[model samples]
Target chain A: MASSDILLSVRDLRIAFHGVEAVRGVSFDVRPREVLALVGESGAGKSLTARALLGMAPRGATVNGEIRLDGSPDLAAARGRRISLVPQDALSALSPVHPVGDQLAAAVRSVHRVSRREARARAVAALDRVGIPDAARRARAHPHEYSGGMRQRAVIAMATLNEPDLVVADEPTTALDAERREQVLRVLSEQREAVGAALLLVTHDLDVVRDHADRVLVMYAGRTSELGPTHTVLGQPRAPYTAGLLASLPQDGPRRRRLPTLPGTPPAPGELPPGCAFAPRCPLATDHCRSEEPETRELDGRLVACHHPDRIPDDTATLFEEEQPA
Target chain B: MTHLLDVRDLVVHYGTVTAVDGVSLTLEPGETLALDGPSGCGKSTTALAVLQLRRPDAGEVRFEGVELTSLTERELRPLRPRMQPVFQDPYGSLNPRHRIRDAVAEPLKVQGRWTEADGPTRVAELLDRVGLAPSYGARRPHELSGGQCQRAGIARALASDPRLLVLDEPVSALDPSVRAGVLNLLADLQDDLGLGYLFICHDRAVVRHFADRVVEMRDGRLVT
Candidate 1:
């Protein structure tokens, strides 16, 4: 898609909490009608970046750098109607006291001046769109009454009630089962198509992103390590950390040897190493990587921020080797 | 080999809601049986009932030929060490204020097997077995990453020397990459220790990889 078709553009976005930089200078774009995945481990600043985009960052947090949304609309200034968040925990996100329908209707009324009756009708329709079998009845049920999958659907319905231009879904399918996960993902995909909205899907599941996201961004230690088309980035990751992540997933069938694991844990924000934040865990880190930070450079239509942006030659072999045994 | 756990016709109810209906399963020694199903399909409830954490309205939960359901809380206190749970949210499951050593040592302490002299050594060994550095025992839960916390949870579960470990969505909260490591660790631990696992999860991929047999559930009933 062309640059004009982009719904959101982030450049050198930095966010810090109490002098601890949670999100370093990170840049990416979300195109209209596209699913862009922000893939990273926990504490990698993915959630923080998503929260900053929707102006829901924690109190006393400082956000810097450029964030441009479509039509000159300052996303930070926009209300929930323009930009909505589908939180990770569906159980906690929905209020236990109120009926799900009432909660959804409130979202619809927030954006448009609608009567209570009209909002309820719209809420039922939204639930129906998300494939809640008995949408009308489900609308009247409280959060506790609904199953985890149904609760997630309710959350999605509320998020899309205003037909927001952008939706930031953080680990939306984490708590769902396999079948329910597929259903929830399908609903998300359908919503993106029907509403023609850009989606910033922040998740740790590569399988979810591999099939759903058109573009992918890899984040580590609060910085964007790699960004490119989903297939290209996942299939042939240039960064060592990205390659390690891809190597670590269990194959579809059976395997013989032990699964590959990254060496160490991600550094805490306050204790991040001076040079490259991932140097400690990165297998290909050199003395230079521990002394100077790498800059993002374009290589084959993808942005990679590594001093050695070469693909791991043995990654595919190592992954496949374990699949075959004598 | 005798079954480590035998759950027959397990029926658990939450008020008027039947969370687990007539669920029957068995875990043999050194085998991992995965319970796969959609959310709210009684998988978790079944796990809880097996551990007697939830009172089953009907059914029998027998561990090593002993009926667990018939035991009162006080009577079942000692049985706790024989069966342990590795919860999904490792961060939440472990106490933030306690060091990893203390979290793992809690089970031993509760069982009165933990002495100050041997607790540290045992904790270090458990951490090493779970692929964590011995030094990690001194660090608190907040100091470790999600995957490490999960490993620590597994270490704690193993510390009890349990014959059966009920792992509830053990790796669900972890990243896909880190997930494999934990799965492999569980598989290795089971093989080495000859432990039986009631592996409850929603991910088909992980189930297929780690489970010796798969049981599917739907709406509080077993489909397969």
Candidate 2:
């Protein structure tokens, strides 16, 4: 992570809706050509933090702290041609009434001054880039006419039409099946390689992040709980919450009847407890964890927020094996 | 163990389009059967048909030895409590304006088994069982997270104490990290209560993890 190569930098960012802090002082940096994943449970503010980068926070939400895009003061003031988003729900994001080709053409024309015919040609090329089999025929179809996977490809096509510097994908593979998920991820990877754009992928899928992301950030209760290399954060998590999450996944080898779950639910916005937000559910919580919030500390090159960070039992194999009954 | 719900040659047609065609399956007590397929493959239609929300053009739905296809909507009203569904989208499934307590108690009320005196306590216990706080009973759908909403949906589905629960992509809308938690919760609930589950999803990984048996569907028909 060279400072010169950094494309996006978020520092002490906080978001509040109706006086309730949804994202509490989170910070991370995205390099120019690497994929950084923000992984967390629902209500962890991963999506909110992504939206904050584009100044797309919900109405009436108050944002504090700094967000610098390519060293710019405000992301909203940055050229629209530079930053783009691929939203989660492709069906809802795309207009159902219009032809898919027209939507892509609009995106093309919005970023570049081109004739309608030229924009259509660029749209077709973009669709082709995303591996939609019949790019020309599919371009003429409406959003509803395309399959769910095809519609998602079209959304990606639209997101990359302008060859933006940064692509923010929020749960891009939520409803997609295993095959379609692979296809979509492959397309994103190709786009990153060809265009040299930074990717900020916000998802709940640990497998996707582990495979595709260069770095991983674990968010809990609207804050960054841990950040490190994908393998370290996943394989040997330092934070108790991250370890609990890893324990809960059903991996390849075996299966357990019940995964070891972190007790208690996600804290509601504006109601988070003092000290560590995860302290209530963390098994390693002590008096220090309950009274004082731990600051981000560098341990083995990864950033972790915990008073007593220790090694979690390497029960991955055992837990997974237990999940499988004879 | 007796089969709690059985579907044979079930077919659902929307005009000429066959959403679910000739699907057959049987779920035993305390078993979790996963129905998996790509989008538009008719897994949802089969579940809807079992609930009698979609009338099948052909086939029989047997619940505890009783055939449901021949029953009219009026006759099926009582049985509705015996078989309830938990949908994927909790926000859409739940009435946004209704409090969690009211939403969870609605099924019991519809079955004419709920009274005002015990409704609150039952709802509280249900919320707690689903990993939500008892105070969450006062919150609306919009006030909770996607996982919490799904938990509420599960709690509501369990309110009537049904023998079978049709989980239609129940955890699909959740985050990957949260999904494992919910799936574990479902497994715990099933083991504790000895409930039968018809879990419908498109994710193979989830199906392999949560189900005792997996049934694959394609174009409204079972492929395997």
Candidate 3:
């Protein structure tokens, strides 16, 4: 892909807290009109990395990296106008005291210095675009008035009001169920199509990512495990951790017995041992894995970091299949 | 075969909202029944009525051939040990300040089954049975990880030795790697103890794997 087509690019991005690194040397790119998913469990440093991209890192975090947006050298200055955030928890993400219209209007004015009347009109149009019924009347209601799904739509509307080039959504559909999950994902995909914006989706739900994300980035213990197209990575995972995550989902086999699980817990900050962070729990870990950290290597249109990679036998259909008979 | 628990035409409401409307179900001994539905769909509300925690507005809850909806709290005490609940949030359901041993033994103490001679040993055994070290009983809930806290919750639920367990989204809050272990533990407990499970969840994938029979709910009513 051309450099101009890439909306956001990061090189050697690292976040440290009091001498301990939380996000270690992460690097990637998000192209225009593409959905790039960053998948990981708790303490995987996905959220921290996303927050740092928008100049909203956790308190006392030390971020060191080269983050460039298209032609702009300064990313922090063009945060709202060029890049925006769609937070995980929609209920508390929007302000409680003010009307949603005002919040949306404020977001619009943050990027473009439009008049209040024009901003309000644009806010209503944005809310209507996100499929909220009676956008004009609903915009007048407070955050508490809307349902869970409605609140998420309002958040999305505000984030995309200015048509930013890049939208960093951290677990956007986590709070919704299967039915609402589909609705929110449709809104997001449609919004992406309407406004030619790149999406950086950070989430733990592998099932959602398999269907929605165009590309996938697997993270483990603050390090990049695997990066490839969604189908390639899920069908034939090149990293051990990625395979473990895929295997953890209930497969479409003959029986729904015990699931294959990774043995140990995710390492916390400062708790990582010598060598690869995932070596403690990986089934294929060897002596070399325990002593030397692996580097990302390009292979088969993907980047993988591991001593031994795996390709599932029989080419499974998909992860999280609806039902398997007993 | 006689069912250990039965509910007929169960209807529950919260200020005319109708959280659960006309739900009927039964659980046979050693059987696993999963309830699948979205939020605000009355899966949780229906499960609550099964335990008689929320007395139904218009329905019948019979446990071991006795109706619970019509019984007083005092009259229901003797039959309470037959049904137990394992909540969703491990941190909130348990007392943070109290040790794991005390939390696991509280149910036994309530039923006047606590004996200094066997209480400690039974608590350790329960912890071990749930794949936790016996020494973990000395730690508080906050001191343990999400997986450990959930195991402690299971230990406490199993302390009552109930024939039926009502688990509400037991593993939703846990991480994926940790999720399978907990689910496996639940499966093992069900097999070993001949326990009946009323598994309530929003994810049908988990329900299909963990439960023997599936019940679907939507808009406060069961669908087909």
Output the number of the TM-score-best candidate. Answer: 3
- Runs in model 1 deviating more than 4 A are A1-3, A71-73, A314-326, B13-18, B55-59, B70-75
Give candidate 3 misplaced runs (Cα > 4 Å): A71-73, A310-326
Q: lDDT score, residue B172, model 3?
A: 81
Question: Residues B65-156, candidate 1, lDDT per residue (tens digit)?
Answer: 88988898999988888898999999999999999989998888888888889988888899999999988888999888889999999999
Q: How many backbone clashes does candidate 2 have?
A: 5
Candidates 1 and 2: which is better by TM-score? 2
lDDT of 2 by residue, A1-326 (tens): 46678888899999998888999999998988889999888789999999888778899999998988878776764545677888889999999999999999998888789999999999999999988888888889899998888888888888877888889999999878777888888888887677778899999888899899999999998888899999888878878878777766666666555655555677878778888998887767887888898888999779998887764556532322233434
The better-scoring model by DockQ among 1 and 3 is 3
10 residues in a row with least lDDT, candidate 1 chain B: B202-211
Q: Please provide, for model 3 over B102-217, each residue's C-alpha lDDT reduced to its tens digit, 9 standing for 90 to 100.
A: 99999889888899999889898999999888778999998788888999999999998888899998888787778888998898898899999999888777877888889899
Interface C-alpha RMSD after superposing true interface residues, each candidate, one decimal:
2.0, 2.1, 1.3
**TM-score to true structure, per model:** 0.92, 0.92, 0.94
How displaced is residue B212 in candidate 1, in Å?
A: 1.8
Q: Give me candidate 1's TM-score against the actual structure.
A: 0.92
CAPRI quality of model 1: medium
